[model samples]
Each structure stands twice: as C-alpha cells, then as structure tokens.
Target: MRDLQADLAICEAATPGPIQMKPCACGRCNQFLLSITHADGRFDPENAKFIVEAREGWPEAIQRALKAEAEVVTLTNQLYNCGKAVFERDQARQERDNAEDKVDRLEDELRMLQDALNQRYQP
Candidate 1:
C-alpha cells in the first residue's frame, strides 16, 4: 500500500500552496486527480512534481479518520482530568480526617487539665 501522507509531503515540498483536486481532463476516462497548485488555481505541468489519482471515497475516509483522531484526543484529556479530580478529592478527605483527629485530642487534653485544677483547689 502507498503511504498517502509521505506522498503528499513530497508533493507539498516540491510545490507551493495547498493541494487541490479536480476531475482529470487528459482525454482519459473520468477520474479524480490530485495536484499542488497556487491559490489562483494555476497549474504548470512542467513544475508539477507529482500528480496522484484519488480513488473514490479516499477523501471521505481521510475526513472520518481525522474526526476520529480528534475525538480520541478529547477523550484522553477528559480521562486525565477525571483522574486528577479523584486524587484531589481523596487528598482533601484525608486532610479533613487528620484535622478532626487533632481536634479530638485537644478536647481530651483540655478536659483532663480542668479536672486536675478542680481537684487541686477542692476542700
């Protein structure tokens, strides 16, 4: 199988502007064609580095692949964010539990000190 991207890259490097497609007009059978041309749609056969015959449905397949790739990227980002949020929530819960434990210890110490003072001053 031919590497479409590599072929496109070579054509792009050899020419200026974006790649364009049009129906072949070389007196041959009706077929779609690919070529690099300037924005004004000017094509020079002498400077043409390469011309590819685009098979039917090739363009649509490329578009679908591009859309699928974009969706994959978006889903990957969302997964990462969800993992981060879970980690942060667990960390916050741990910190709150530790704080509560410290408060309980302080309250117990305060009660003991009050009892000691009362006994010392009792008749």
Candidate 2:
C-alpha cells in the first residue's frame, strides 16, 4: 500500500504532459505517462496497472511500482528457500547420529561374544 502511494506521488510530481501511445506486452495499444502523485494519493495495490489517462508522469511511476513489486517477490522466494535448507540440514544430522549409535551397539555386542568364546576355549 505504501509503495503504491509512493509511486503515485512520483507520477504526480512530474509535469502533466501528454500520454504517449505505446504497445503493451499484453498485446494492447496503451497510453503511458511518467508522472507522480501527491503523498495523499488514494491507495490500491493495482494502482500501477491503471493509468488515469495518458499523462506524462504516470508511466514512470508505474514502472517504479512494478520494479519494486518484483524485488519484493524475489526476496520472499529467497527467504522460503533458506528455511527449507535449514530443515534439510537438521534432518540429515539426526539420521547420521542414529546410524552412529547403531554401529556402537553392534560393536559392543561383538566384543562380548568374542570374550565369552575365548574364556571357554582357554579353560
């Protein structure tokens, strides 16, 4: 919400020039502006997608908002990946510990059996 308002403010600050007609990626003939609005602009997450008309300053604002949104999404993905890695590491450590304990128990049983056989043969 804050980001939307900030981008709008940037658009409002720019001169209200003519809207430039351009080809949008959505295969539409769209008008673009590079303008900013005031600090007290109305808020909407989808504000970047909707231009009030073909104003000069609005295009730049929209671009900034889109870029910021992308960055936020990337950071969120990184955070989730980091958490998953930590969980995997912990699971691996627990498995290794369990295996080591089993090896120790088996070695102890083998030693006891060997001692009993030696005592019987020597006597």
Candidate 3:
C-alpha cells in the first residue's frame, strides 16, 4: 500500500538525477559513537553496537532530524518540477504535431482547389 507517485516524487522533486551520498564506516555519526568494534568499514548486520554518550543536548539531535525532513521536502519538490516540465514538453510536442497535420490538410485542400480551377478554364 505505497503511493508510487509520492515515491518517485522524492527524486524528481529533488534533482534531475539520483541522489548521491558519501559512504560511512559502521554507519556511525562521528559526533556520537566514541568507538566502533570490528571496524568493518560498513554497517554490521549482526554485531552492531550504538553507545549513546549523553542525552543532554537533545535539541541538536532534533534539529538533525528536522534537517533530514527538509531534505525530503527539497527532493520531492525537484521531482514535482521535473515531472511537470516533462508533461509540458510532451504536451507541446503533441500540439506541434497537430498543427503540422492541420497545415498538411490545408496544403492538400489548396492543391485540390488549383486543380479544379485549371479544369474549369481548360479549352
């Protein structure tokens, strides 16, 4: 039960291409996690340990969370703009083709009219 458009909006709303991120060892925040055991250079699935130093400055953590929320919003906006532009471009192309078809029809009609005039005036 996931909204597909909302999912795609995450990237289109952000930028033209995919989002890039720097890899982290053990997925540890440097400000947090004084030490990480095993040094796997990646997040450990089984032997993961996160030791909280202190909870004195929860506001800073909250701010970090909000920053992540802002990133999501920015990404969604990018996707929305990209999708809109694509839609508009498609519409424009369709309109142009329709106009071209109309011009072709008019040209054919003019040719028919010229042929009729010639037949009527021919000796």
Candidate 4:
C-alpha cells in the first residue's frame, strides 16, 4: 500500500498549485471539450470527453484535493502523537502497579513476623 503522507509530501513539494485546464475540441464531432491537465502532465480520462459539467468543479476539485491532503496529514500526526501518549501512560500505570504489589508482599511478611514474636512473648 502506498503511504499517503509520502505521496502528499511529494505532490506538495513537486507541484505547488492546481492542475491546469485547457479548452479542447472533439476530433470527431468538432465539439468543445473541457480538459483538465494534471500536474503530472496526464490528461483526465483521455478516452472519455468532459462536457464541462461545471467549471466550478475544476478548481473546486483542486482545492478539495489540497484541503483533503492537508486534513489527512494533520489527522495522521494527531493519531501518532495520541498513540505514543497512550503507550507511555499504560507503561507508567503498569510500573506503578508492579511496585505496589512488591510493597504489599513485603508488608505481609513483616506482619507475619511481628505476630509470631507476640505469640512467643505471651506464652
């Protein structure tokens, strides 16, 4: 599986803006085709022609892609930091529990020894 962070980093570093658009015409029908040229120089669906559903979506798609990429990056960082904090907290809790268990064991031994001494003195 491709890492999204790496892909986004590469995209942001290499291509810093929206994909270019070129107004083209259909070869067979001589009809106008709205073409979207990506930063990678690849045309959008070369086989299928776009009839310009909405010019708004062209730029909107770019903005959405950029926004989505940023959101993913932010969420990924949050998840990593949260996971590390949870692991640290769990480790600290385990250590405290282990220490308490050791102290309880020592206290029980001391109580046993004191009780034996008291019985001997009474008798």
Error of 2 at 76 (Å): 1.6
TM-score ranking, best first: 1, 3, 2, 4
Shift of residue 110 alpha carbon in model 2, Å: 1.5
**TM of each candidate vs. truth:** 0.54, 0.52, 0.52, 0.51
Which sections of candidate 2 miss by over 4 Å?
1-57
lDDT (Cα, tens digit) per residue for candidate 4, span 1-123: 334454444444443334444544335554332234444445444212232322343465577779899999999999999999999999999999999999999999999999999999985
Sorted on lDDT, best first, the list reads: 1, 2, 4, 3
Badly placed stretches (over 4 Å) of model 4 are: 1-56, 119-123
Model 1 stretches astray by more than 4 angstroms: 1-54
TM-score preference between candidates 2 and 4, better one: 2
Per-residue lDDT of model 1, residues 33-88, tens digit only: 65655545555653354443234235645877798999999999999999999999
lDDT (Cα) of model 4: 0.62
Whole-model alpha-carbon lDDT for candidate 3: 0.58
Residue-by-residue lDDT tens digits, candidate 2, 1-123: 235566556556545546443333455547332333334443343344345432544566577779989999999999999999999999999999999999999999999999999998995
Top TM-score: which candidate number? 1
The most accurate candidate by lDDT is 1
